[model samples]
Target: LAKTTQPISMDSYEGQEVNITCSHNNIATNDYITWYQQFPSQGPRFIIQGYKTKVTNEVASLFIPADRKSSTLSLPRVSLSDTAVYYCLVVKQAGTALIFGKGTTLSVSS
Candidate 1:
């Protein structure tokens, strides 16, 4: 099974766009790649999911390449309030407890 890996931290200025990438070299056929954002002391909120190509929503855009070995999450025109930890997980279905690693902490400054 492919496990996901992301950076431990990232820094960005307010009003700037940010992109975080994760690598999942061994992603399984039945697994779906999901991204989540979490604020301090709060549970993670789903950002996007994709098996291939791209998926976009109100908060972010997810881009997956053909090899399925990596994916990127793009946050546009970020604000200071957007500072949070981002997680990428590969799972078989929704509502499952994601096996989390140390997530990437995004710091947005004004």
Candidate 2:
């Protein structure tokens, strides 16, 4: 598991692009995209897990780049409906229980 550093809170206006970057040292090759989301009182839900590339879904876009030590989760056109608690997790190369970043709170307003 790698120690991660990221912002704890972010504010964005409606239809604004928000980029939250999490940097971890010594991320493994198979570490993949380590992004997750947790709603209300539910458990952390896996959102994206990818390699050193760019992956995009209907919700957000993730970029691992070629550095392998950092990743950026991009939310396009965020709205008040998108406010939630999102976090980054780095699964170990051995595929065992691992670590996560101090979650981030994304607040969107009109």
Candidate 3:
């Protein structure tokens, strides 16, 4: 598994966009980048994913560079409800196990 690096905390304002980046310097070729969001007392939920280039869902967008060493999760027009710990993970194509790391806490204030 590739070790990921992310900011410990980030601050943003309501209705603003937030982009949290995670670095995986040793990412494997078969690995995919997955982003998960967790609230105070809840388990992480799948937010977005991508193998390369860009991927977008209703909640967020994930952008992966060609080298696959890093990825960014983009939240458009975020709100207070979007404040949570965002986790970036590198996983095998068919793997189900998730190893959580110290995630990036996004603080969205009014």
Candidate 4:
């Protein structure tokens, strides 16, 4: 697995957009970028994923540059309820066990 780099924490106000960036300089060609959001004492939930370019769903958008060395997870108009730890994972292949590192802590204020 590739190691990811992210901010230890971030702060935002309600109705604000939050963008968290993660870097994986050693990412493999077959690796895909995946983002997950985890609340207190709960399992992480998949937010978005992509191999290159961009991918968007109802909850968030994932942007990957051509180099594929880094990715950004964009959340639009976040609320207090959106506060959580966000993780960026590099999945090299299917059936790989999920390994997690300390994720970015996002605090959304009212």
Task: Count clashing pairs, candidate 1.
Answer: 2
Local accuracy by lDDT, each model? 0.89, 0.82, 0.93, 0.93
Off by over 4 Å in 2: none
Per-model TM-score, in order, reads 0.93, 0.88, 0.97, 0.96
Clashing residue pairs found in predicted model 3: none
Which candidate number maximizes TM-score?
3
CA shift of 101, model 2, Å: 3.0
How many clashing pairs in candidate 3? 0
Candidate 4, residues 1-110: lDDT per residue as tens digits?
A: 88899888999999999999999999999899999999999989999889999999999999999999999999999999999999999997683677688999999999
TM-score of 1: 0.93
Compose the digit string of candidate 2's lDDT tens values, residues 32-67. 657888777788887777777899888889998788
Question: Residue 108 in candidate 3 has what lDDT?
Answer: 93
Where in model 4 is the C-alpha error above 4 Å?
none
**CA displacement after TM-score superposition, residue 33 of candidate 4 (Å):** 0.4
lDDT of 1 by residue, 1-110 (tens): 45789999999999998999999998877778898889999999888988899998899999999988899999999999999999998878554567777889999988
Better model by lDDT, 2 or 3?
3
**Model 2 root-mean-square deviation:** 1.6
User: Which ten contiguous residues of candidate 4 have the minimum total lDDT?
Assistant: 92-101
